[model samples]
Target: MAGEYGLKRYFDADAARLLGGRIRAVQPGFDVEGYAAEVDSRIPGKELKDRVLVLAEGLRTRLPADYADAVPVLLAILGDELAEGEGMFTNSWFLMPVARFVEEYGLDHPDLSLDAIEEITKRHTGEYAIRPYVEQHYAPTMERVAHWARSPSHHVRRLASEGIRSHLPWARTLTMFVEDPRPVLEILEPLRSDGSEYVRRSVANNLNDISKDAPGLALATALRWMEESPTPETGRIVTHGLRTLVKKGDQQALALLGATGGEHVRVPRLSLTPGSVAVGDTLLIGFDIENTDGRAHRVAVDYVVHHVRKNGRSTPKVFKLATLELGPGERRSLEKSHAIREVRTRRYYAGEHTVDIQVNGLVRATGRFDLRT
Candidate 1:
């Protein structure tokens, strides 16, 4: 069973050793000491996934129904190394054991209450995975989160903002709140002007999530927040959050930020070497850009490969071409080769496949030709 697990394969040795020290300090047992010694003796940067797996297995079987004993032991272990005074853990690794513990034993202790839930929330923003269990096990406890929003701890306040963000980047989707973010918005309204940048960034990211599915709602919220005298901190948060909308040229977003399109920087001419590609063949695509604009312009150049399906459903996938910093009247030439792979479902239409060069999110040039089977 341990051989099949990839957790240890992915765990970095350095991270494990660091985590092991903390583990040895908190989790008292013969195995923990043995594992810690093994990890400490290993070359730095070795991963501890296997050892953690062993620890997890031990807990799953040994942990009793009354988490009272296990809870304090874990808290003291976490508290000694990670959690000092204000509810901050020592490191992200500290969350691994706790998360594993929660995943394995959460339902067993259905009586878990508000205080325990709050303590776990302080573990990490990525802890959102445990929200369903929290809501199921401790409904009344989660409700009290609104009250804790006013707590002086930045950690608690951040949890209020971040814990509910609908689209936390790189995290799993929170579809429920993304649809109607009202409950969380109440928590954000007060924390928007939070004294800590930590809390403010979370608030901004939360607003950013609201922007994706509901652009109109996001713009309205931004406008509403703008009307009030915004602090510099709040302004930064709002601006960063609205970056996507601003790039997509949302009118309200542009007007509120008082930003408009600048002079169109002259673009370069593009050329493809083969000009045509065969399935399983490599196509070399190249481009030359001459910027005649007097001022320097930053441009993002990319290509969209339009693939025609067997059933004639067309889908385009964007791939990066280049990011250029062109100076006044500069000429730059770039080239890249793309391989054509014959996928099982893809049918070559025996006609021209279109591709276009995109400049800073705008399509500027077009090229097309046939792909032979």
Candidate 2:
């Protein structure tokens, strides 16, 4: 990146040295400096994985002619570099680059690539790398991944779910899983009670990704996991997995967790303070709810702010409030502050923005605020 730096630096001079040394250690005569120069020239303008592939293209030329011979040689070098305690961003951070390397260099040879990818995942992770194999060899690759769900290595178990994420951030989308995610749930079955939190979090994220395209599959998977396991660990997966669906006010998702729909609840008041605010200011939003029926009710209350974009159109983004039970005749006032700060993901435009108070997935009250430039 020209302006600032982040993950792009993961492949730098040090990584070049480490990779060059490993290549030479295994293959007697290799072009280390020429490989280093290509890496240097390619990295100047590219981001993390973009630069990784740029260098991987150069790296492929220097390896042995045999695909099967080259794959294990690289895997052996990676094993040599592994330390006892390697964090995601540590010295062993080389796995991410190595994964991309395999994705590019070893596509023609699935079996060899699969073997190397499994070894890469056990220590760091081959989730991003495994996608190509899954895309190229769908059924067989997934069969191997399913078995990894039961692997003694938590990292391998994590890869079983993470590698197949429908919408994995910073990685290519797995279209097979996106079109039909039933197979993904099959992979998650063995890891529902995974002893490691690392593996469980991966499963939750994979399920969450499934919710974007296949909400039904995501919900069904969560329900089935809960029914089969019925444990606190499995319950956590449901809460995290259905979060996006809950944000969209999916009635089935709300009902799954016990929240009353808007029609069933009574909203007597809704208001936003300081009708007009500056670009980077604070706006206080408040609303009041009352339970009308004789029995208590569980509710998932949220506020949807329809932010105006530069084109004069607006999109709705839901923010969660409180989830609680209201007894009969009991009224509660809930206030959540809105920070009108600038965010990289969302650019704020000067215009009239509307905020709606919602119960379950229903809009009970709407309020407007003018954002001043």
Candidate 3:
């Protein structure tokens, strides 16, 4: 039988052998067998991030004890920069541990480590690895990151935005940026209309993270970006960046996205088909919305699934449904199916669940369903 699917499988013995072999090629004195064995022994039963750390630790043991001395070897083994807008994870996943090694061991050597991270990110990703430097060596790192924002390589440019995200996934939160995002905003300025969509998307995500903490600031920034550029690309970045605020129905956010006149829409009927479902079943939700206003209006329709938690309390998750314009007296019917399936991120509890039809951030109608264990 095939083994269960997991991220850890990606960093198993074979990956260690590959990484060890690369290190051996660069530093002929490197002990490939011992390094591979150490990673193989420590990796079993560890989670994905932990497994990467294990590989990093193996490198620590085999590489030269001095961080400065080790820098040249790591750089020599980086191979080549990924093609523009490619290889965040697909191209060189093995380099994750190499980046991690720089993160864990290269802190005291900010310039060297930053240089290494810049090169590593070109091939794989230094997003996770660069966080500590931002934390420990704030001024210098941000200065370097600002310079990277203008790099010729899209990968390096993306690192400028992605590396400084306040809540980058799989990485520690940058609380300093969360509290005061001015620095991050400055770094993102040049990247607003970057040539690469890959880089632009990171800028949007970074703005999204900023929105979570400082909605007003995020809104203001989005508005300014729109006013300054007003290009389709800038519009996409602003819309995605303000998604959380838009979901919460922030008036300015909705207005910026042209999802206005929510109050003039009426949901005459909302139905959840077969109101009860067990895990792994699909539930169809249908609703009819009519424009009550005499003038045409843009509508941003969304749904909220208030999932029952293990404690019996519920938390709301907003899902995007549709965005359309309705003329005077126009009516539209929309349907969406939601599958209640097992996933790593969430657990479903058997109980009553609530669904709300949200238009332009305002809840127009609500319904309920029972979930069976």
Candidate 4:
């Protein structure tokens, strides 16, 4: 996998060449080869993430000592707006090292870091780059971030929510936000109904990250957002934000989303077709659900397959079927076909596998299937 383009050529000599040319275009006196050489020398065999800082280190060594001056040169080379279509984020890879350098050295003059990041994000993203800055200067830094939530550019608004994620992937976590996310939530609240799907997704992802460790706060926020004013965009945001807890069959999350409250629901018929399957084959599971209560009930029907692993053990994986409201004394029939195949993330072993049907968050029926290579 490391031999593939995602990592193998991401920071190779060719990348350095283009990056140097761009920088040299902005600052004619800039040393291009020196920067490229350092990038290449330190980049081979290293993963892409390691190369980002290495590129930043190269810039540190070869660029002007004045961070303010050097930043403008980088900014000048960046396009005025994010690229459209194929090469998106490609041009911005250069910004990673630029932001990394600022993360480490811009503590003394925090305003410069703020300025550089705000400008840089328009052409790419400062989400990962701004984490350390926020961690170091929480009060002043987030004040600016909170202001960014209202910016004209959705990209800037996204940075406002993204940079403050407690568990941002490929970036350091904001520990303060992890402990107390009020400030970050304050930034996100206004943007819940943001017009752009891009910004909305980031806001939702931020909430989802918060949900992992602070489910109550996340649920409260989602419920409030939905109850107060849930636009199509905001509705999508809440749905995605609650996705993790829903997958885990969290009863509170289920109930909050109106996908629960099925105390009188029953699965009278549940079975796997043929009761046997082979690796690389497909299995169909069918079920009949009845609502017995004298009131309407929302049911989130899910199925769990206990997969057999090579170590002679099994792990349960949940698959969502449907979320439909059922009237009193009503019955609904549903079926789903699941494929068992060799996947990069899982290895299948021959064994008897168990399956269960869940209503709301409760498992209501169980069945079994055999799997063989």
Which candidate comes out best when scored by TM-score? 3
For candidate 2, list the clashing residue pairs, or say none. none
Model 4 agreement with the true structure over 54-169: per-residue lDDT tens digits: 87777776778987777777777766687333222565665566667777777888898898888878877788778877877878898999889999977788899998999987
Instruction: Output the lDDT of residue 29, model 1.
Output: 44
Task: Please provide, for model 3 over 100-148, each residue's C-alpha lDDT reduced to its tens digit, 9 standing for 90 to 100.
Answer: 8998888889999999898988898889889999998988999999999
Rank order by lDDT, top first?
3, 4, 2, 1
Instruction: Give the range of the ten consecutive residues with the poorest summed lDDT in model 4.
Output: 83-92
List all candidate RMSDs to the true structure.
8.1, 3.4, 2.2, 3.7
TM-score of each: 0.61, 0.86, 0.96, 0.83
Q: Per-residue CA lDDT of candidate 1, range 185-237, in tens?
A: 77788888888777788888888888887878777787778778466776787
Number of clashing residue pairs in every model? 9, 0, 0, 0
TM-score-better candidate, 2 vs 4: 2
What Cα-based lDDT does every candidate model obtain?
Answer: 0.61, 0.81, 0.89, 0.81
Q: After superposition, how far is residue 318 of candidate 1 from its true place, in Å?
A: 7.7
Local error of candidate 3 at residue 153 (angstroms): 1.3
The number of residue pairs in model 1 that clash at the backbone is: 9
The CA lDDT at 215 in model 2 is 92
Q: Highest lDDT: which candidate?
A: 3
Please give the TM-score that candidate 2 achieves against the real structure. 0.86
Q: Residue 104 lDDT in model 4? A: 71
